[model samples]
Structure formats: C-alpha cells, structure tokens
Target: MKYIAPPRDAVDPQVFSRMPLAAWRDHAGLIEGRDWPSIEALNAHLPAAARECFVAQTRELLADGLHYERRIAERGEIATRERNWHDLFNALVWLRHPALKRALNARQAAEVARMGPKTRSRAQCALTHFDEAGVIVVASDPALIAPWDAHDWHRLFWRERTAWQDGRAQLEVFGHALLEHALTPGKLLVGKALVFHSTQAMEVVLAHAAAAIAHGELLCDPLELRPLPLSGLPGWHPHSDDEAFHRHAACYQPRRTGRSYPPAVRLGHLGRAALV
Candidate 1:
C-alpha cells in the first residue's frame, strides 16, 4: 500500500488542547516518524533530544508501557501459538522423518517425548510459567521486541524470530490512526514508513483467513492488551447518555425564557418570578 504523508502543519490546536497523557504516549511513534532520519543521516537532521525521545518512547511502547500493547497482545499471542505448533512439528519431524530419525539417538528421542503434547493446556502452562518468570520474556514496546539481555541472543537461536518481527509489523499498522491524528505536531515525517508498513500488515491479515484467525486470537486474549471503546470523547455519539452531559458540565445552566427547560427548572423560575 502507498504511504500517506501527514500534512506539514499536522498539529490540530483543538486536539492538542484536549490531549491526554494516553494520547501523547500512544502517538509517540507518529511524532518520531515526523523527524526520523536514516542511521547514516541520523547525525545531521535529527537532534539529540528528538532522538532521545524517539528511542525512549519506542522502547516504552515496545515494553508494553505505551499503546503498542494491543499490537503486542495480538501479535504475541498468535506468534506464541505458531511457535508452539512449530515446536510440535519439529518434534514430529524428528520422530517421523526418515532422515531426521536416523540422525537422532535414543536419548534425543526420549528428550523429545519429555517435551510432550502441544495441546492448549500444556502450551498455556508453559507460556504462562515462562512469561511470569522466564529469563527471556518477549516484551511489546512500540515497534520493536528485542531480548532484555543483548548477550543472550543465542537462547532463542532455535526459536522463530520472525514471529516477533511479524507481530511488530502488525502493531505498527494498528497504530496508524493514532499516529496520523495525534503524534506529529508541526510537520509529519519520521516514522511514516513504519506506519505505512504496519498498515500493510493489517491488510495482509484481512486478506487471509489463517492470518486473521491468528491476529484475532491475539486480540481476544484477556492477558494481553484489551481494546478500549472510543465512546467517551466528543463526536463519538455514545450509545447511551444515562448520565447526561449537562449534569457534569460546570457551566451548564437552564434557560428561564424557554419551555424547553426541565420541569424542575421551570418550577424554580416560576417561584422566583412570583416572589419578585
């Protein structure tokens, strides 16, 4: 998909006035995108402060501190399932494939057996245990998922790193709206490519049922990021207004001259007028 560049004056004053902490953190990628420079060009265009903010924000997002949690949940869950399947398949391959079986010794076969079934319960237990206390936990910060320990990359040597990559790609896409509308202020540029690629991930998943299922499972996992309803803000047209806005607005006042006022207001006005 073609990339859509945000306008030069992308910052909407009105939106900024209403901005919440969540919006700032959630759209940091978009802000980073606005000033992102290639590694080679990094020394020239991007300032140290901006770069610092970008790295910090991206790291925060990837670590599940930012809005990237949804992406992490969606991508992480699916990737976990896929990895489990791959592990099971590898075990089966070792056992059933003629070439693999010949290469494995009796001890190796026993070890594979110990690995056991790939059913939901076993996989869930394994993942939960590892996630809770595993030395190598996959963190979902903004657009990257690197091991907490840089020197121990070999631990995951047998694992599929592509799953995390794919998950990040998916997340970058899911956050496009936030980036476009909330992140960049004066001019948009830096992380735009990331957003574009991220969006493409979404498109690819929608086009394929298997991909959709994986993404959906990731989205539905309760332990992961939960999707929040966007109904509280203005223009959302909430489904119900049981607690009327007028009750909460400090400046709200009923018009005395109009019959449109509620019964209480009308009676109060009538009593006041009669007393005067």
Candidate 2:
C-alpha cells in the first residue's frame, strides 16, 4: 500500500486533552495492526515540518508508555495487573500499524527460518504461542489504506501518528525483548515504578519523566506518586507539592484500629524524614 503524509505543523497539545476519548480510541483502532508508510514514502506525501511533527509526537508517546510501565512495575504489589496493562499498551502500539498486524501472522515462521541454527532455541519455543493467538486480524478499508493527502484532518491525527512511530521505535530498540519476555509467565522479571504522583502537576512533568526513563533513570519514588488535581476539582490545593500531597491525601486508608495516622508526607518531606 502507498504511504500518505499528514499535514505539516499540525500538532496541538490541547487537542489531545480536549478531543473526545472515544474518538481517539476509534482512530487508534483504525490504525492499529497496520504498517507505517516507509520514511521515503512519508516524505513524498508530507512537508518537512509536518514530518518532523510526526516524528516528535511518535517519540513522545513511546517514551510516555515506557516510563509509565516502568513506574507501574516498581510498585511491587500487582505483577499480574501490571503485565496486563503492559500487554494492552504494547498491543495498542503494535496495532498502530496495519502492516505489522498482518505481518505478525507469517513473521514468526519466517523469523525462525531466517534464524536457522543460529536462533536462540528458547526464543523459538516461546514464539509458538504468539504465532497462534495474540496476532489479531482486522479488515482494512480503502480510505484507511490510501496515502495521507493532508487535507483538513484534525491536528490530533498528526500527533497520534507521530506518537505511534516513536513508540514503535522504542519497542524495537529496548522493548522488543521485553515484549517477548513479558508474554510468558516467568519469561522475565520486569520492574515497575509509579511515575506520575499527581495530575495536578504541570504537563511538563510527563515530558521530564519520559526523558529520564528513556535514559534509564529513576523518575521518582513509586510509593510517593499521585495524580495532580485539575483546577476546580474537589480537594484541589494550589500551594502543595501537588504530587506528593495528593498521593498522601488519596491513599489515606483508615487503620482498622484507631491510632493517629502520620501526616501525609510531601515529596520534599521525604528527605527530612530520611535525615531524621
């Protein structure tokens, strides 16, 4: 199939937040299980600025998912839950391309044959199951298959496309092995960390966390993470270490026996407590 380039300079951060969740989900489904147009083909269809936007967005999304997974794994309570989350996100990433989805059917046998005696016997043994069930087959429409003409599509389209590409590259570089290992029980032991402690924090925090995790650093302590509250949301406090304070506020489960519970510790407070 031919590749079409999305419009140039079409990214809008607000679109991601304001677009209806259902629309995003539907668009995701449409693109999932498809292969991306080759870089050369994309260049033909889109302007340089648009192409750059696509690349930037792709990198952002991939980095976001990777960091999120790492943080979740660090918590130590829910391996299965984390695995499921990882699987779903990974599948979503895979599904971003129709070609990849279709190719998954024959890629396994082909991969094994290509590897031959040089193949890791363990890897061959593992892929047997994925070759059978996990690869999904979905019908494709001609419009979906056509190249992106960069007409009047929404800005979010470019953003989503960029994010998907970046996420896929990350999977190829760092997460490919992780995908194989995570597929089976005991295949691997992946750690998780809770990266976002509060939704109330600035959007820049996500960018910062993504950067740190991409470079293999700890973004924050998992136990202390929480979502920052949106303005006008109940219990929103303007002057707190929002992430830490909200985490403490939300996680305040009463003890079965009534003794005074310690005050919620802010992220900044952790150092003082350590020194004490």
Candidate 3:
C-alpha cells in the first residue's frame, strides 16, 4: 500500500510516542503544539553544526535552477517543502544527525556531478534508499546477522528479540520516510540497513558510517543493504510480541532464491559485529 501522509492538522500527536518514531520524538515534539513549521522555523531548529547547510524553502530553490543535492553541496542549503510531513521529517533527521545527513548530501551531489543531473547511477539509487529508509544497526554479536541475512524474520526478530533491549543490538532510524510512515496507525515500517560489527558507542558508529559514505567507501550498490522489518522490532508493534506474529505477519518476506547479502561492514578494533 502506498503511504499518503495525513494533513498536518489531521496528524495525531500520539503517533510520535511509537517505537519507530522514538529517535525523532524530541524533534517532532516541537511541532505538536503549533501549526506546521515554515522553512525558516525548521532552519531555526538546526544545531550549530548544521547551521552552514540550513533548510531552504522549496520554492526558493526551484528558482535557483540548481539540483537539490547540488544546492546543498555547493551552497549548504537543503530544499524543504513547508507543511509537508515528508520534508518536515527530513529536516528533523538533519537536525538530529547532521554528519550523516551531510555525508549523504555530499555523496549524492558527487553522483549528480558525475552522472549528470538528468541521469542516475546505481550508487545514486542506493544512496537515495538509505536517505529515505535507512537504519543504522549496530550488533555486538556477529551471529545476530545470520537470520537477518537469510530473511528469517522469526529467528531474527522473535528468537533474538532480547538483543534489541540488552544493548547487544541497536537500531538508529536515519530514514525520515520511516518516521513519516509511522504517522499512520498500524503502518508496517521496514528499513534498509547497513549493518556493522563493532562494540563502539552508537555515536562513534554513526560517525564512521558518515565518513565512509562521504569517502565513497559505502552505499556503492543497492544490494549491499539488508532489509529489516521494523514492526518486528520489540515494542514497535502490538502483535510483534507473539511468536505467531513473526510467522504469519504480512511483513515477513521469505528470502529470494540466489539472494545473498555481503558481509557486514567490519570496523576497526571490533569487540563484536557492530553498526554504522
């Protein structure tokens, strides 16, 4: 089913309390009591580190004739549509993860320059996928990735559910679209993840992911990303706690024939498989 965002006035403030939107609740809280924020208001929320690449109203960028990514790369301006949930969530992601957002913008702008704004490369597709639905999954145990790679939702999400709460595995939502989708009640959210093996703090892993992306060492191909059914994550959905849910949920997709994922990105000084 296609996701159609509700009007700003129609969105329920309670949706932000959901697990999938947990990472964004702090930013989303800013708008719960007021009308949708204007582009200028969105810019005001940007942290000092992100002040250089500020949010610009979409209309203003349309007249500039620069490609969206290129504008951010060259002029440090992110084109954002006011009152739109998608763009609003995007701005929030920018506020929370400036380095990662900047890295994605840099890579995208580089692709635009190389492939021409009229065309797109495989790398661009992967970059866009991550930007829209990406999750940074850090795992302390390499064994945890087996079920995920095999698309075994039952084993990965149910059998190993404890990993989610014990800090053995953690998911940081990077895709604004996922946050946007959570606005709909009972919507099933899935994330494209770049799993890494490490024991480093989430912030350190995120920094590594950003650096890797900016340096063109990651997201070179769409196949490199792994699918993760977000609903299966503990506390993400009401039914997920039941073993039957993992077995019968619509989101549980079987592994495709001949499909195999590449190894997780292994960071230096690893105590276990980690994330970025």
Candidate 4:
C-alpha cells in the first residue's frame, strides 16, 4: 500500500506534541506555525558547516545520473520535495543531528562507490534501514538492556517502565521516515535501534555513535540493530499503560528462532569501549 500524506492544511499541528516529535518541538515549530517552507527556508536552518543544501527535487535534477547518496556526497545537494512531510522531517533531522547525518552520508557514499548503484550490500541495507527508521536507545544502566536482548516486552516495558521517565533510558528518534509516519494519529511506531550502555551525556554518546559509523565500526550489518516498539514506551501509546498491552499487542512480537543481537555499545569515562 502506498502512503498518502495528510493534507498540509488538514494536519493538526498538535499532533507533534507527543514523544519523539515533542523532543523535536523547537524545530517543528519553525515550519508548523506558518505556510510550508520553501527550499530557501530549509537551507537557512542548516549549520554553517553543513555543506549539503536541501534543493528542490525537479525533473531536471532527477535527469542527472548521480545516485541520491552520490548527489549529497559529490554535489552536496539533498533533493527535497515541496510540501512533503518526509522531506520536511528530514530537514529537521539535519538541523538537529548534523554530525550523525553527515556520518551516515559518508558511509552511504562509500558503499555506493564500492558496490555500484545496481546492488546493495548488507552494510548498505543496514545503513538505509537506520536512515529511514532508526533510534538511538541509550541506557545509563546496562541492566536495563537485558530484557530487550531477551525480547521480554513485558519486563522491559512494564516492569522497568519508570526507567524511561527517570532518564536511565532514552529513545532518541533519528529517522525522518519514522517522524513522517508519526503524522498518522495513534500510530504504533517501531524503531530500528542501536543500543548504547553509556554513563556519559547524550551529546557524548551521539559523538561516539557518529564516529563509529564514519569509522566503519558500527551499523555494519542489519542484525546489529534491535527492533524497538516505540509505543511500548510510557505515554507514547494509549494502550501501553496497561500491562496486558505488552503481552498481546500486535506490535509486540516474540523473539524469532536463531535470532541474536550484538552487545550494546559501551561508553564510559574511558571513552567508547568494546561492545558488552
């Protein structure tokens, strides 16, 4: 099924006042209170070091043989559509996480160079998945991640629910497509998560994550990511407050046979350590 965006005028601006989007409220407010922003408006939001520009996607631009990733890496142009929720969210991501975005672009451009535009490797697939629907799951306490590795939804979401609010655990939404999907009222969003057990601040964790990506130390394979049901986080979904919701919701899938996840990235006073 094709995704049809809600009409710009018809979409309630209040829809962004929840988790994930709420985290980005400042950026969203820039475009939400007025008419859809033009490419120039989007470009103005870019940081001084952001070489990439959000250019209008046109037939003329598409006619160029360069692939999308190549266009950004080689020409520093990001093809963006006018009035597109997905593209708008992408610009917001660029504004919020420029370093991470740049790292992802660099890795993607490298992969495109290695495997031509005709084929994608496991690394490219992992990169694309994260680019579309990724989340950074940061846990101050390593113990908070055990249930997630075990796929114990009830234990993770219900028993340890307080961890989410207390800052011991956090879900930093990093994918524009995931943000676009949030436009649908009451959607149960899931994120492809890269887990980190860190004692440092989020800024530090983000830096390490970006460096790891650019250095080819992370996001090398799809299996390295964990499936995170975003709605299971308290207040993100209406049904999540009830314990039974974790047990029976369609969003809560059991762990598959032969499925195993790599250890979460570890960040401590010594800086980034090996996965544990």
- In candidate 1, how many Å is residue 158 off? 51
What ranges in model 3 sit over 4 Å off? 49-60, 269-276
lDDT tens digits by residue: candidate 1, 1-276: 433434435534444333321334433332333353332232222334321111222443456532222232233211111112122222222222222122122222232345532323333332232222111112223222232112112221213234344453232212223323332332221111111112223423222312222222211221222111122223222221323531333222232343221111111122212221
Q: What would the per-residue lDDT of candidate 3 be over residues 172-256, giving only the tens digit for each residue? A: 9899899888888777788999998888888888988888888778889999898889999888987888899999898878889
Each model's C-alpha lDDT?
Answer: 0.26, 0.27, 0.82, 0.85
Note the clash tally of each candidate: 14, 33, 5, 0
What lDDT, from 0 to 1, does candidate 1 have?
0.26
lDDT of candidate 3 at residue 184, scale 0 to 100: 80
Give candidate 4 regions above 4 Å deviation: 30-34, 268-276
Tell me the lDDT of model 4 at 98: 85
Residue pairs of candidate 4 with colliding backbone atoms = none
Ranking by TM-score: 4, 3, 2, 1
Q: Give the TM-score of candidate 3.
A: 0.92
TM-score against native, each model: 0.20, 0.21, 0.92, 0.93
Q: Stretches of candidate 1 above 4 Å error?
A: 1-5, 20-176, 183-227, 231-276
Rank ordering of all candidates by lDDT, starting from the highest: 4, 3, 2, 1
Provide the clash count, candidate 2: 33
- Distance from true location, Cα of 56 in model 2, Å: 26
lDDT of 4 at 129: 94
